[model samples]
Target: MNAKRKNKILTWIATISFGVISLIALFPIISLVISSLRPSSELMRQGISFSINFSQLSLDNYLYIFNQAPEYWAWYGNSLVISAITIVLSLFFSSMVGYALAVYDFKGKNFFFLLVLLILMVPFEILMLPLYQLMINTQLIDTYFAVVLPMVVAPVAVFFFRQYALGLPIQLMDAARIDGSTEYGIFFKIMLPLMGPSLAAMAILQGLGSWNNFLWPLLVLRSNDMFTLPIGLATLLTPYGNNYDVLIAGSVLTIIPIIILFVFFQRYFIAGLTTGGVKG
Candidate 1:
């Protein structure tokens, strides 16, 4: 075959392979969404199926979530607020730390970076006890602070940002400094704009992490009102009765923010990941 024709055939094969993989990945999500529209008894009886019974589906589950369950709204709000705060704060602090590690010379810098790496090696489960105790000592338990504080200096974010920042030209910093820009001014004004791709990537990751985080929030939040979506949805199941309709519907709804987030930042995702990969 001609080279161009051979390449085109290969590309077609790759496209078909990816398309098949995408459908395989999407099946569960599609099933969950279809199941959510079904009656709880129907779902329980039939389970998730390939065969569609359009007659049996309704928006009753969604309606029940909006009208009947005030707690669900509260939990939704809590997740939104906590995730927002966590994403913003984590980006701010992690980027700063990463930038410093990338560009600056200071005492204990290596030590701190080492500590971050060590922490990454240790599972969060190992730290959970000490962190909980620390929260108790500070009396931050059952508060939003408990949820947001520990996540602000995420190790992975720091490392990712540092790797990304390494690819940035230091000449910009020197020029800004020569122009008498303050350190913070240089970072916030000049460096930050250049770090857009990295920030976007981290924002999506951190936002998703905070949004879906259940264990830490479960431990820290004593009240139902403060529960994040994951915990709240989990609570839908009890020994007496299981609210499968609302649970499935809420699970479906929970996907919206992550989707919206990816849509907004997707333009930068590939660019950021590519840059980080090359630079690192």
Candidate 2:
């Protein structure tokens, strides 16, 4: 075959392969959506499945969540608000620390960066007890602060930002300094805009992590009204009974914010990941 024809054939093969893979990845989500439309008893009988009983499927679960499930809405709001704040703060603090580590030289800078790397090596579960103690000592238990504080400057975000910043042009910062800009001005006005892809990428990641975070919030939050979506959904199942009607439906709704977040940031995600991965 000619080169052009060979390349076209390869492209078709790749496209077909990826299309199949995409469908496979979407199977669980599809099953969850289908489960949400069916009765809780049906789910208990067969669990989540592709078998569509056309006559039995109905909108009662969706209707119940929308009209009757006040707790679901509260949990939804809690997740959204906490995720938003965590994303903003994580991007802000982590990016600054990462940028400084990548670009600047100062006393103990190496030590600080080393500490961040060490943090990455340690699991959060190991630190949970101390963190929980700290929270209690600070009187932040049962508050949003307890959930938001731990992840505000996530080590992974800082590391990713640092890696991406290594690929940025340092001469730009030098020029800004020469033009009489302050350090903060150089970061906020110049460097930050250039780091758009990294910011967008981290926002989605951090937002997703914060939204799905269950253990930490479950540990700190005392009130039903303060529970996030994951914890709230967990409550739907108990030793006595399972509220699968609301569980499946509420779980389906939980996906909406994540889908919206990805849709908003997906354009920059690959670019951010590519540059971050390949750089120092």
Best by TM-score: 1
Runs in model 1 lying further than 4 Å from the true structure: 1-18, 239-241, 267-280
Candidate 2 lDDT over 21-115, as tens digits, reads 99999989988888888998878778777677979889999999899989999999998899989988899999999999998989998899899
Q: Model 1, residue 39: what's the lDDT?
A: 89
Give per-residue CA lDDT, model 1, range 1-280, as digits (tens): 6999999999999999999999999899888888899988777766787777899889999999999989889999999999999989999999999999988889999998898778766778778889999999999998999999989998888888888888888898889889999999998999988999789888877887788887888888888888999999889876434688778899999996667756777866555444435434
Q: What is candidate 1's CA lDDT for residue 142? A: 86
Residue pairs in collision within model 1 = none
Tell me how candidate 2 scores on lDDT.
Answer: 0.86
TM for every model, in the order presented, reads 0.87, 0.86
